[model samples]
Target: MNKKTIGRVVKYLKPYIPLIIISLMAAAATTLLSLYVPILAGKAIDLIIAPGIVDLDGISKILIRMIMVILLAALFQWIMNVINNHITYRVVKDIRKKAFDHIQSLPLSYLDTKQYGDFVSRIIADIDQFSDGLLMGFSQFFTGLVMIIGTLCFMFTLNITITLVVVLLTPLSLFVAAFIAKKTYNLFVKQSEKRALLTGMVEEMVGNEKVVQAFSYEDDAIERFDKINDELADVSLKATFFSSLINPSTRFINNLVYAAVGIVGAVFVLKGRITVGQLTCFLSYANQYTKPFNEISGVVTELQNALACAGRVFELIDEEPETPDKENAVVLKDVKGSVMLKDVNFSYVPDKKLIQNLNLLVKPGMRVAIVGPTGCGKSTVINLLMRFYDVNSGSIQVEGNDVRDITRKSLRDNYGMVLQETWLKAASIKENIAYGREATDEEIIAAAKATHAHSFIKRLPNGYDTVLGEDGGSLSQGQKQLLCITRVMLSVPPMLILDEATSSIDTRTELRVQRAFAKLMAGRTSFIVAHRLSTIMEADMILVMKDGNIIEQGNHESLMKLGGFYSDLFNSQYKNV
Candidate 1:
């Protein structure tokens, strides 16, 4: 609806502007040449029928001219269409690329706040709608407008009084189109948005299928899906109803105008105000004007649908992301990897603190381990360390520099992290292990060997060239963890964090992984978030957290000597393992 945004969308056509212009010119030539056929028809009737005499030579020349023009125009139009369609498709590809790239630059909070289905729907389906509008609107609608205008002028020249009356029906056609199109656009927009939610639910359900089956909530999931599907059905029904009415209603109004013009032309001929040939010419032009009117009306409805999609797509691009640092923000550099958390209270939502009045520090190269009950802010330390979310009170510092003052990329680049769930994409083992780092295959193999993954990788049919399934389904959990650790090793960050990396593996695998973890932790500041206390028994420092507060801290032996929370947790938590 906004012209400026429309202009921005049109700017996408800049690269193809010359081709588009040729297409428009071809449309004009076709329309104008085709108009001559009627003129030839009128002349043939006047000379051969009205005069009761035939001049074959003059008639043949007119016939040949019409045929040649028709052939040439058709060929030109066909070529233009071929060229224009290719360009339009390319423009669509570019739009998709830009939208996705911008979406990535947005904060992780953006993904959390928006529905996954809705976001994807905008990029895929919604962008398609806009692409259709741009392609067809430029190629057809503009040319149709020129045809309508040119044909109207020719009609007026043939017979002024009749032309005046025929032009009157145009407003009626416009009114019908405007009213129906407005309503249909609104419906389609709402339908697209709601459909996104339904699609999103489908995606979420499928992704979490394991959780659904494990919890025996299959029936509940089905019921929720049914509700969304039902809503989708209802909205689609209404949207189609409105959209379908567009053509029929517009056509009906146009037919009424066509009928009125035909009747009026006959009356004019009877009154002797116009010749029979001229009356026929006026009749032909009436059809000419109305044909494009119908086309423009149809384009109007199509444009509405495209605009509906535009609205959705624009809404996503316009979303205000979580604020990153300003352009002038400092890059925290040359760190010895000392970390400080001073009186830091945190929450995912208001009035619900996850960590409260927390304070801690770890000197460079110390292995600091955090142990707690399931929800006692153990992983929150890593979150705080990474600055995924800012603290509600107090500040986190890296080597005396406030984390908030540094750019997020710069701060995060200084650390390497391995989480409890090691996510792997579908890629070659070498690429997956090296990931985004600029590491040579030699470096990558070295890192893999360090994490005990190189031997298993080499045993595969393709070795480093073997492709992984989604989330590395082909590999065991411990193997996946080892590869993930190898990936972090390639990054070689100054600080390291392992969040329950070995917690879920088998005892034998855990022991092997523990050795690898120990190797990775040497000569770097490390934070280990663990529930299984045995894994952290060798930690240089242990912090016992209960309900968001650090209740005890010391080396494992000293904490056991104190017989406090750490001792109680160490004795109780890992009994099964």
Candidate 2:
């Protein structure tokens, strides 16, 4: 077991200390009543010492007392179980909530490098596994400890010499349990890791199944899945095999203790040192004492697995969150749309430089279009503008105020964005369009009509109330993009970012949407990223980027006359058209 991880888990129980105390009291009551039953049975046996001399009335009184004690023990046992269930589930709920909240605060840079399904596995599956083990530990561990101690006290009162014999053999059972538990912990850790890997793979393949089938990669996907599945199976089997050894191994040692006590007590009875009734009571105590050893060994096995799962959960909670905003950061308000980048440098990795010494300036209400080949840092500039990433060494200013000085929320609220990839939740169309802002039915319908999406939306069975599945299920790519455009149109912020926003729509719809976009961008400062040269013909200024540097900048007419890189790029697309 990991002492550090176990200690952390115990801290979650502090809020429920009173409940824990009550449960312990119940466990004690149950153990005391159970111990007394054996003594009553022994006394009843003494009353029937000989056939002719049997005291029927005395035996009957002992039986009645035993029945009452048994009923009380059952009641307390039930109370302990109910309380344990409550405590175990509450602790699991708290840990899960903390993990999820921490994931939200993490930086995008961290999220970009990890698999979504692995996080899902940790929060859902791994935490559930930990809950199961924790529940078992609570239900059995404390009761078993009290029973072991209580049985030993009663046994010593009847026969001290036999009780010593049982105590002497305890170390062997402890040693066996400890060794197996130590071996099983690491195996369980490996099993959890493999399970997460499998989950990630499954999620990826299912989400992109069309791409796999289109490329005839089904066999390769299956091979990769089988490899991970085999690993999980192997580790799980080993973990189970080792943990399973604890109960029987401890029981074997316990049986030896029971047999030794029986033999020793019988010898004492023959020598007149103890009566047969006392011998019977001592033998019962011997059996009771050893039973907890078996039960405790089982608890040790489960706790090892629980601690392993808990270690994974704690790792997520302990991750460093994104750097917080300044304590007294100013909120941006009523902004002109001017933006400036001065001597900015940034890279996703430290060793490789992507953008360096870059500079640009855009005035309010200017339509500046960025054009380049695929890896020319077109979208990266948008990322920097939005503060999704910070510049390594220089400054970005909005309306002459340093962007770092402004709160992120207010800064983001000033701009509207629509990407090539459209994302919609599993919700009604009206709800999807009205996301991030409160809008009435008239506003939502107007925005949809403006984007030329109202006709198709009205054709659906439920019209505006149709509930789509995850990511706008069964909706054509063109339809999905239109909804995203409607979302931005509804807000109409002071600044706009449109990156390949009309790529998925047909040429005719693209023409109509571009006109809608023109009206929307009439007075707002807009940054357009495009691969098709014709879409950006009328930009106020065209920036031709190559290798993260601006190779050319001018109006389209001037760039075409200069016959530079931009001219050749435009002519190539023109010929293709």
Q: lDDT value for candidate 2? A: 0.91
Tell me the tens digit of each residue's lDDT in model 1 across 1-577: 4455566667777887887778777777767776767777776555665455687777888788878878986886687678768877888888788778778777665676778888788899888887888678766787778788778767766777777887787788778777877678767777788778887888888877889899999999999989888887887788778767767877787788778888888888898877777767777887887888777877776777777787777677777766769778788778678998998988777877789888888899899999888889888778878978778889999988888888988898989999988899998898898785877889998888777778889999999999999889668878888888889978888899999877657787678778877877787899988877788889899988988899998999999999988777777866666
Question: What TM-score goes with each of the models?
Answer: 0.92, 0.96
CA error at residue 212 for candidate 2, angstroms: 0.7
lDDT of 2 at 23: 92
The local distance difference test score of model 1 is 0.81
lDDT of model 2, residue 27: 93
lDDT tens readout by residue for model 2, 205-286 = 9999999999999999999999999999999999999999999999999899889888988899999999888888887888
